[model samples]
Target: MAIKSFQGARKQQSDTSEDAPFKVSDIMCKDLITFKPEQSVEEVIETLINKKISGGPVVNDNNELIGIISEGDCLKQISESRYYNMPMENDNVEKRMVKDVETIDGNMNVFDAANKFLESKRRRFPIVVNGKLVGQISQKDILKAAISLKGHTWDK
Candidate 1:
């Protein structure tokens, strides 16, 4: 009886999912859909919805991420227009894109990335290397890492 209880206690102390190791690049979305700063807000919204993405990075001719545009930002403009009965004309991405964008390094561990996700309201973070956009990581991506790491059982 004591041995059975000891075995059960040992099983309860087994390593949890958080004990596993993974990297940001492990689960980051590589096929990124990006937009240009000069793009009109209308076009931005169209691309975002069509792509089924919540947001994307705004890159320039040099492949540098200048800002990030999201559905939330576009909706704010749209909501305001409806409230004031104004026209949604001449709205550019540069005008609404967030200039102070937060980026993450591709090599960073998933643990730190998860913490960052919990710390901010932003759903996604642009992955950068040498100051150039490479990919994008989202909260879902981190969750993917957690599931993939923990759900796989190693037949030891």
Candidate 2:
């Protein structure tokens, strides 16, 4: 189906060229490679390096999101371990993960999500459905959604 702004139930007249509101599911990345709390920090870093990702959501065995792990979180520990000449293999992700993660609803409008990005310093948000991790929405995803919406204009 076409993503036209002024069409069907969303055909309300508006001044701006943009009008239709899109949801997070329209642009969120579904195929996410998640990590567990018990997993090693070294392994997570290796995966992030290999996959070319900056971070990933930390989840439990039941697939419930617990925290978020990023390269910034690992930097201090990695440096300290390297200085002490300790084994990085045993350091778990939980030790450095940010536990108070802010998640977003998958049904939220992409515009609202964009505002979140603009107002906050976070690079990405974990999209949740019924309290379970479903997907991820990045700044790039928001930009992509905006570009897709640009092709659609108000009928008025």
Candidate 3:
């Protein structure tokens, strides 16, 4: 008599669906905390603390992407204020924000976005479309995406 097997044949691992979303837009946070160039640095600091965010993109009144401001930038202002004995109230987002901003396209692959983070050493990347700030993707977002995609074979 042949030995009986308790387990049945297992199904082969399937590839992720062709339509599966793997782009930055799919994983990025659309409801973003943004700033304005003329906004007071003190206001930015307060919002950053209240929202528990490190930084955000600065936009124009027309909602166009202008620059990025971070906690580090705020700190720089604070430091300068202390060093020069100047009033923090005079500082604004435009003076503190990094104007030469690097943004990511919404359609880029999440994996590619991860590489960009590594290359740029950025904590977050603003997503822009048609010169407007649309959303942001963070290192935390990439980590969340990776964990959510676990157990699946990556296409690349």
Candidate 4:
């Protein structure tokens, strides 16, 4: 008797299948709470608290992402003010926000984006297109995408 292979037929990756890679744009948050560089740190803090967000992107009137301001940046201001015994005045997002901002492409795969988050230790990434701010992707968004993609083959 001839010995036969026991493995079942494997599923081939298909571009048109539901298992197709999900892009960052598919899950990114389009409605973002952005701030103006000239906005006060106090105002940014207030919006962060009210919106229950850790941080937000600072944009120009043209909606181009210029920087990112976070709770940690605000806390730094607080600590410095206390150290100098000075009031938190004459402070704005531009004065404290991180000007060197890293952005993610909208067409990038979600898994790749997750790897980026892991490597960079970033809580969120701004999605920019043609030098214009479009959306944002967060750790939570990646988690949600993973959960949704469960039971599907993540070949990539």
Candidate 5:
């Protein structure tokens, strides 16, 4: 009976640890959508609507992320123009996007990433390695991680 009990405890501990190895990479969205700096805002708006995404990373022809554009940015333009019916021709994404975008490394811990997200008002953040965009970590991802880690204790 003691041996059987020991085996059961071991199984429980293993299961707990398996589910609790929370990492930013584990929760980050790998299937990332991206835009190009040269793309028109109208085109990007269409893509955002069709994809049902808030925003996406902006990459160059060499697939290097230069900036990001969000729904908020689009909305700001509309508000500034007093709801003008003209297409987004004169305005470019590069002009509106946050030039010095903050990024997180993929290998960073989920806790640190979550802290950064909370500290900033930006809805989304790009994940990069060696200055190359690999994926994106959003507020949603951090919330999911936090929920997963709730009421859980880890061994040192």
Candidate 6:
């Protein structure tokens, strides 16, 4: 049998006719950590620290996304509250969570996802499907993807 040439092999590998366009679902992390609306800020903070996540979507009992909480939101608590003898019960995620949330469909393209992130004030966004929370996409995730794709043929 004749051996295939290196150039022929390279050409075959480069052919992407069957390749699908990149979508948010393809890159988004599906194993999402979510917080409940009734959960205290302290509990949420513990989850964040344990997971090493900047933030996550807050969902109601029905698993519908209600808001998003981030490290920024946590910091807001300290900055806004007075240092007087305040009760731990005074701290709650709902009080500090950004209720006005912006979200994207999982099927969105990476370009559109990145655009939405840039246009919005929120650094993290919840990925939804049919109004249900599925995953989270953050600035860090976008930056990671950008760096991973650097100097690659896909950059063209």
Query: What's the C-alpha lDDT at position 147 in model 3?
Result: 86
Q: Could you tally the backbone clashes for each prediction?
A: 0, 0, 0, 0, 0, 0
- Candidate 2 Cα errors over 4 Å, as ranges: 1-21, 154-156
Please give the range of 10 consecutive residues that has the lowest summed lDDT in model 4.
12-21
Q: What is candidate 1's lDDT per residue for 30-142, written digit by digit as tens?
A: 88899888888889888988989899999999888999999998998798878899777767888889999989878888878888888886799998888788899999888
lDDT of candidate 4? 0.91
- What C-alpha lDDT do the candidate models reach, one value each? 0.83, 0.85, 0.91, 0.91, 0.78, 0.75
> Model 4: per-residue lDDT, tens digit, 21-140?
489998899999999999988999899999999999999999999999999999999899889997887788999999999999999999899999999999999999989999999999
List, residue by residue over 1-156, the lDDT tens digit for candidate 5: 354444433334345456764667778898888888877777778898999999999988877889889898888876766677655677778876767888887777887877887788777888887778888888888888778777675441
Ranking by TM-score: 4, 3, 2, 1, 5, 6
lDDT of 5: 0.78
Off by over 4 Å in 4: 1-3, 8-21
List the candidates' TM-scores in order: 0.80, 0.81, 0.88, 0.89, 0.78, 0.75
Structure candidate 1, residue pairs in collision: none
Cand. 6 Cα-lDDT: 0.75
Which of candidates 3 and 6 is the stronger one according to TM-score? Answer: 3
TM-score for candidate 2, residues paired by index: 0.81
Compared to the true structure, candidate 5 yields what TM-score? 0.78
Residue ranges of candidate 5 with Cα displaced over 4 Å: 1-12, 15-21, 83-87, 148-156
For candidate 6, write residues 58-154 as lDDT tens digits.
8888788889888888877766665555655578888878888888777777777888887876677778777788887776777776666654445
Candidate with more favorable, higher TM-score: 1 or 6: 1
